[model samples]
Target: MSGIFLKQADFFETNGILFETGGFFLKQAEFFLKQAEFFMKQSDFSEESIVKK
Candidate 1:
């Protein structure tokens, strides 16, 4: 029946949206982690420079 097909299509669409949102969050988290690592290294270098001076 047409109604059954529509329901199945809707279910698939919902799943697609959830997957896309999850992927976006994962990417954002990875980006923030990289930024944190870079900042940490920078802080360490600055501290070493001060100590040397």
Candidate 2:
């Protein structure tokens, strides 16, 4: 009975860490996507400016 309880507790702790890690990864991916989008826009604007010149 005590062993079962210990196993359950370990599972819960591991699940919490998994959830936290997933959230961190999602946030990091979003940050990178936004950064890429910003650079793309900047590049497009520069290209247009050069074409105008």
lDDT of 2 by residue, 1-53 (tens): 23444444455556557787756555555555555566667778888999999
Q: What are the TM-scores, per candidate, against the unseen true structure?
A: 0.61, 0.61
Instruction: Compose the digit string of candidate 1's lDDT tens values, residues 1-53.
Output: 33444444455556556787756555555555555566667778888999999
Name the lDDT of candidate 2.
Answer: 0.59
Q: Candidate 1: global Cα-lDDT?
A: 0.59
lDDT of 1 at 25: 52
In model 2, which regions exceed 4 Å deviation?
1-20
Residue 46 displacement (Å), model 1: 0.3
**lDDT (Cα atoms) of all candidates against the true structure:** 0.59, 0.59
Clashing pairs in 1: none
